[model samples]
Target: MPATPAQPSFALPVPVATTVAPPDLTDSTLLDVDPDAQMSLGAVALDSRSDVVYATVELPDGARRELRLDALRPTGDERLPLVVFLPGGAFLRCNKAMALEARRHVAESGFVVASVEYRVTPDGATFHDSVRDVRAALAYLRSYADDFGIDAGAVALWGESAGGHVAALTGVTDGLPEFSDAAVLQGQVRAVIDAYGSSELSAIADDFDEAARLHYRHRATQFSAYLGRPGAPFPEIPDAVRAADPAAYATASVPPFLFLHGSEDMLVSPSQTQHVHQALRAAGADSTRYVLKGANHGDVGFLGHPGTGLPWTSAAAMGVITGFLHRRLDATER
Candidate 1:
């Protein structure tokens, strides 16, 4: 008799918990309810008929997080391109939905998708810590590439909102511990998709007095908890914010870049993408940009998820992302 298939040791794939509860629709939106923090990195979970490997991990201090990678097998022993996704919500929010969405588009593009969930705020962690998690997740995948049949050398970094900021930062800052640390994340990945994220707080600080501005997702109200200084006053956090903003760190050494931004996004300025676009162009890096008309900051969600058919919904994002990933990854594979 043929060998029996091994049972997947992890939970079933989860449908993204859309924020349908309609809690406080105030200026400061609440953090989305979190998913289970299971630390089973490299563990295989079977979903439907497919299997996905979870790159579950715990930081040095034992804070747990997970990176979900597709359990895909290539035709031969050939390896496949992979991307580590970091979802964005200022500095305070995001989850596996962002990762799953990336997988949906990139899977057929000859890429393995890994969605990462970083440690949330008020844990006494900083913006830097979250970024570190991304680096660590990438490294973890590389260390065990063979187990998952992944091509460590071909990994891409992708993200939305704050995730986009981190993705671009990874692109801009080369030779940093995130890339250079052989112990965790691979030192080099071929590409990046910085989807509509901004690092500069000053851009949003323009109309600082408006109470409406404080209520959005991009502002990182949790981040403000540490800053203490008001946005109207333009606190010293710019130096910190600038440091955190990937655009300020753009250099010639960054990777192939694709930027997507909404023309009418109320949360982050479209100029945010422009900044990175110009920086990448000036650096002579391979780059491209898409300006989604009338789309909000959650543009990807509007495009990719089902039932977004009316206008800017999740289903629409799916089509946009599918085309984007195919075009870029196709060129990349060549």
Candidate 2:
């Protein structure tokens, strides 16, 4: 196996002492890496964009399942930082194309990005099953690092909504054997970025407004559906639900977290992230929260509006994420 190149550390782009700031993120010191830098896995171009790879794992029932990961290989040297992204769909389904597009910015910024297609509830799966798959995905990526040119140790997780919940849960419970399948290594997630993820499954249903309840009256609520309990009230939260709550596992040893939630989010509620952030802080762990004003659940606005030239641009978010990864995963100091 090729030795993993030492990840470089740079000061976080945030200005600590500034009388006046640069006009845009372009002027920040963090913009050192040209986002358009060329880096690709050492294979003939699979397609126009990504290559799909399957990672197989054995379930507790002795059944085998294949988890799919769509890889966005980089264009630079071998052994780049790896980022595993899980998509949002209330844990019921995932839109592969949408998820890949959402994380495209990360991959384009000189990292090997893998969009995970973990088991979901509609397949008779539960949080436990999804978590095992998440672990398997990480282990599979690391085990095949040489083949894919990824740095095994410098890995991060990013997810949105339901995917965000799993990402946060996995981050907090990194080394716990319970979360890992026998065939998979315990997850060593070094950093986490959760966008509008639900941590406390029991309370998420209540976050729905009267209009939302009316709209989903015929369908099972997200919490109830995921828990496999129709008509279950918040007061009757099951032990399984509590066990799945990422906040329950928060500790100082967990990796640094960057949470982004829309202030106006009705579904899942911004408080879900706020609670997790509070728990992380209370545990003395590194945490950062960015609340988007006037943004709602799954809003593209959170990714930044290019036409408006806003301060909270996608360029800015990438800087924050890349900077955080450098600080947490890199060995050298700025």
Candidate 3:
């Protein structure tokens, strides 16, 4: 007889009791629900076959946003690990197109993948809104873990560019009272993937100035807007800029991090990733940095496009991600 493969073990998620039903996406009224409504907390709409759910997440101040989560467990496994992906668009908006990457990750890694929508700075928002939104989504996922068959204890945060900064902030600042939400989360992030995210705002300020002198700069870049003053440089807004810089907040308690960047990334310099990685290691946190040679910002090469024929591939990047998560999250499961 052929040998049977060993089954993966997962910690059973705590069941949630609620009378709140899945909201109708078309109803604008459901757009903003009360977070205090226990029955409606983390309310979401779902597709049974795909195991994908769209959660109507309520912010601390009662504003609302929708979060998409795709549950992709291997056949016969009752539950699987979770990986939350934050999309990059500077801080202006969360790109909707990243859903394709989410699906690809599910197919390749068999992990529950979540793509979050955070309020961008262009909507009169700031770094606070983005960070709070990501935290709220994290709480919602854990609060309703049973409904999604997610291993609440095994979770990772992955992001690119601005999204990467948000993920880094959320993970590095875990357990701070101000950052917590209504959902009583029981676990911590096991790993983080930061792909070419700006680690320091001061560096961005310099980048903006150089772009301006070259006559190729937009009147208001995302970083300036995120500082609450569009077209202003970081030197003029030192305090808020410092508050939003992930490198400034790096601590020993941060979860293991994998930093990826293209050596030639002109938008968010590869140096930003390198600096943060150094900070993490200095704080005694586990970290790794990989630079894709001659890759530009947001290019296909960063995602490991084989057609680009770059020396580095997205396959290589994804491989490092899964390997890190497996080592971190799977080890915890065992």
Candidate 4:
């Protein structure tokens, strides 16, 4: 016998909670209750699907990269409007799951929320590639609208920082042939929510204060990399920089836009939002701008988390956002 096989030992399982006594049903009586009384109900049950591959990009070197999105929707048969969210990582990475709590809140409010992932600097993708990826996501969502329980015609774009910039570009450049691909189906964008995103790439550095400017040099490098000109001086390629600016493409036909920016944001200037807002207004487009006082870059103030102990809570920020979406998407009619 091979030296008696060692006995396997197992640790005792820990109880998840203290055991409680069961209610006694024997003496229980059925009592009449008023069914029409006012009551409070919590959030609606939500179903989430993650890592949904929306598109695949084939690089010049024959390498294929898959772009994905995470979707959150209510558990029901009713089709709802779609809100596509883009997470900001300075155009270097696409962190699609960021601010999931806020996204869930939006989904709970009767919209299908999708957080999309696009190619970034690491993939050697330029700003044009990011725009294309977002458009591809919109097309894919529209193609599978029935499966996802989404209304493809009433889609919106929402993003923060770099994502915000991309969302704005995608919104304003809706039907432009240069920014669109014939192979990709395009849908009408009803609204856009841009949070602390730069509208003019070349003016970003100038908007920062002296102290913040020191750190922005690194950001300039990142922008250069996103432009497909790594190690090149930022804003040196004037035409490329202009092409990436959303304000440069603003027109009257663009959909309604809601711009949110932090007054204390040192990374991306608040002026960025103001400039685009003014441009849209000048172009006779509907646009709204909000400056959150005492809020910094990527601030929890934007999310309205109670844990931040700020005077304004999630209710305040999300109220404005959801209200805007409701009006723009005409959710009440649906």
Which numbered prediction scores highest in TM-score against the true structure?
4
Better of 2 and 3 by TM-score: 2
**Candidate 1 residue lDDT tens string, 1-334:** 1112222233321122222122122211122211122112222332211324334545547776554533333234557677677776565555455344335434544556667766545344455666666676677677778865677667778788778877887777766663334454444667788876775655552222344343432344455542333332335456665666677666666777877765445556666766777777777777777665444555333324322111222333444554555555554654
For each candidate in the order shown, give its overall lDDT on alpha carbons. 0.54, 0.65, 0.60, 0.73
Error of 1 at 237 (Å): 2.2
TM-score per model over all chains? 0.66, 0.74, 0.72, 0.81
Which portions of model 3 miss their true places by more than 4 Å? Answer: 1-76, 182-187, 205-220, 300-313, 332-334
So what's the TM-score on candidate 3? 0.72
Identify the runs in model 1 with alpha carbons over 4 angstroms from their true place: 1-78, 99-102, 177-182, 205-220, 225-234, 299-334
Pitting candidate 2 against candidate 3, the one with the higher lDDT is: 2
**Residue 175 displacement in candidate 1 (angstroms):** 1.4
Instruction: By lDDT, rank the candidates, best first.
Output: 4, 2, 3, 1
RMSD list, candidates in order: 10.9, 10.9, 16.0, 15.5
